[model samples]
Target: MTRSPATPLPPPKARRRLRETAALTQTQLADRVGVTPGTVRAWESGRTTPRGRKREAYAKLLKTLAEEAAVQAPEPEPKPKLEPESRPQPQPEAKPQPEPEPKVEPEGKPQPQPDSQPQPQPVAAPEPVALTPAQAFDALYAFSAPALVRQTFLLTGRREQARESVERAFQTAWEHWPEVARDRDPVGWVRATAYEYALSPWQRLRPRHRHPEPPPADPGDRTLLNALLRLPPRHRRTLVLYDGVGLDLPETAAETEASTPATANRLLRAREAVAGRLPALADPQVLHRRLAELASNERLRAAEPPTVRRGGERRARLRTRAAIAFTVALVATTALTVRTAPTHYEPPVSPGQAVRGVPQRVAPGALSDEELELRQKLLDQMQDGPERLSPRLE
Candidate 1:
């Protein structure tokens, strides 16, 4: 019997590992394969499988990319040498000063020595205590609110909208504290939600209110942030999620509602765009450091914890119930009004007379010639109305 063909490797694991090994982002791999980033994510997610020619092509491209990466990889740079003077040389000691002569004590009374003051010991800061779920949500809101607001501002390019989005997102978290507390990254969820809310078109429909001006951006961040803002919204969001927010590829993908491959592609494109606009960002280390600094600055500027009340969910439920009750009441009242209110007046028919299709008896009275003539005229007018117009020929 002929030897069987070797079993093919599973696409999801193989794709992920190969892409990572090659240091190629999902977007980069997609570019090479001429497929959408989502397609690559699907491949890695096992949502779909490659087959026949596509499978062969995928395997071949992965191998080629991996090999190319290996070939082009740079050797580690040597550490810089330290100069002798720069190596922390010891300073020479000064000669001891001549000692002062001791004064003799007078007569019989013992001389009292000078009283020494005790030095104050340095106090260490207390470590933060672990918080309960409710406490944690409050702390998270206090610490994260400003950063989230700033991030939203960057995304929305409007201070008022950003604040609204952040507030809405936090309120949502507050109302569902248990669920939010259980989330692996509550801050990330909040940030992602705020970003989504900021971008929603419905927000534009809300009544506008005057808001205080937002704080100024850091001088260092201004140029880079402006350049980032110039990118397409998707690209900007991806970059912020990855570098600014410090989310992993998968997390960023989920937050952005994109497939892993698509997210990767957006991140790659975002970086490229930013690098094109700001040459310093072309160096990954420099870019990472800058993003870290920006994130740190935002954290440092977070508002102090304020008193927070619980029962946000209860309040929301109450509001919902109130709205529903009001609607029902309004509907009932309108229905009652419609039922009881007097309708347009209609003439009372005689007992022997017919009104529409209902027969009634008429009163015994003889009709005058003028009355008959008036009735004929009224009938003539009804028959001569617009509906009796003849159709015009073209």
Candidate 2:
């Protein structure tokens, strides 16, 4: 015989009331109580009763449902009232008054008047001092941009790129002269600016260039220093800032926009990358000496004045501009003359023509039309031959 399906427990009195107040269907009540719709209907119709613990739980559920229903139901609104009527009154008349006369003072005596408050005059503000680029450079130089740059390079391991970033930082500081000049620590502002500039996209866009070879005169310092310089600019920046410049972990992290732990990890890895390649740098004193050399070298100095005659310089500049314009116009005219000049034509070369040739550098007006055509055709064939001609040849 097949086994009969087990009977579901009956719903309790509280569950029946909860289901009615909740406006839940028999199926909804059955699903919540873990019973069937038929069982919920049978219990609500008083044909069955729920057992022990389920009965107690159902009572608590009914109480919560009733409370929810009470909160959600809307209250009855108040009724409107009728208005009362009013009575009318009387009108009043107008009255006129005479004009007052001006008073005359007795001989040699002034009339008394109300005390008048004195008005304060506005004060003028002082003018701002204009800063020259040279002055800006000097102020930033004392604060150690070179050391900051070298440190950034050591940290990032990209020397040339880092230097450009540092140069750009100095340029920006120069542009913000008024603010930087007033700072209690101008050097700190410059260093922070340089470090932030290095992290920007403009730094990444700078043309990559060769790192200068370590100064050979310092043989004692060449090994480790050379390897350090050879590393990529960003890594070099990181190492320099953390190890060479003696920045604490948090400061290094701040400049690099990295966590202190990440900064420490980078420092460890950079130290290892250079340790084996340069023996001198392995020694702490050697490393310090190399850093000192770099710090002294990486500074922005004032540019030397251009050589020019002192008196009547304005007239000299105008004369120079005139000469440049005149030269450009002459060259343009010559080009037009040459283009519009008549040209002799030549027929195209025959197939497999065993052409004998002399290779010579042509002066501006040396080549005849046929010669120029032949030379250009030969150049085009050489440059765009085999790799590009396969389909056309077939």
Candidate 3:
């Protein structure tokens, strides 16, 4: 017959045994349980007991330690035999005590009670801070010009056009620094602005029919740019700002002038579209290589001096400046027209003295629509006068 091995016995009821079994110094365990070595000594001496879960944890811990150490427990001492007695004696019964009465407080007097332990209070979350306009602008320019140009190329599918668009956008953003700088996502803001200009009526109406070739990827990056370029202008801008650039929803929405939910939807659709197209493309490595090549080419292109490519970028800068000047001129002209237009004040026709129709004097500058209308009305009134002025006697 097989015999079962005996289970190990517990260690001696001493503080040293606890310290050794728990693999902790008496001071360490006391500190951990928020007690002192003196209290631990009382527990180990059996003069006091550990309370609650800590006692169970410590007891089980010691048991596990003994098993791991493979120590054999000594046999328990045998109880002494009792001597036989001749006769039993009757014992007296004790009477039951009355229950304690509840305490009552007098009216209008508060009862004093011991203070309880303090409850833990929750900490408030820190607030999100906003960035200043100047700071925002600085952050945007902090991106290397090459990186910005590469991002533009990936979004637009044409390297030269992308570079031109980015340059114009930056120039415009710089000119309106105070305004664009207020934006939380200045990079995204500039990107969207570039997309708008690239798809503007003037650009669409231009005679050139050149189309962008699909970008060739390099080692580090290989995403195809064509998949993104095929999206509708707004969707493309939204996707490029979110997925390509890694802007959060709020920032993307602010940049695109779209609601957060709308921006999220656009990004989802854009991603789905790209994912759908990617399967047919077969090798993802090719796409990554093409993107890397695009980035490297963009870096090289940006490093070139502006004077060398003055023909293209110079024209772009001139066009942007002209557009700004024209916008300013248009606003000023509109304001002047509104401010100088003649007020429609009818000269209170004099109470008596043959009140004839009055003629209006045109302003020194070009005639305004208001002035023309007033003159026409006065002419009609004069033509209907009671009698013709005998040709205004000289």
Q: Top model by TM-score, which number?
A: 1
Which regions of candidate 1 are displaced past 4 Å?
Answer: 1-133, 157-163, 202-220, 295-318, 333-394
Please, what are the lDDT tens digits per residue for candidate 1 over residues 368-391? 999999999888775646555588
TM per prediction: 0.47, 0.34, 0.38
Across 80-144, the per-residue lDDT of candidate 3 in tens digits comes to 76655744667888889895554557775555666679999999999988876545544565564
TM-score of candidate 2 relative to the true fold: 0.34
Give stretches of model 2 more than 4 Å off. Answer: 1-138, 142-167, 178-185, 192-217, 230-234, 283-286, 294-394
Report lDDT per candidate. 0.72, 0.60, 0.61
Distance from true position, residue 99, model 1, in Å? 60
Tell how far residue 389 is off in model 1, in angstroms.
53
- Stronger candidate by lDDT (2 vs 3): 3
Cα deviation at 313, candidate 2, in Å, is: 22
Cand. 3 Cα-lDDT: 0.61
**Tens-digit lDDT track of model 2 for 221-258:** 44445677566555666677666766666556544544
- Off-target runs (Cα >4 Å) in candidate 3 are 1-144, 180-185, 211-223, 280-300, 303-394
TM-score of 1: 0.47
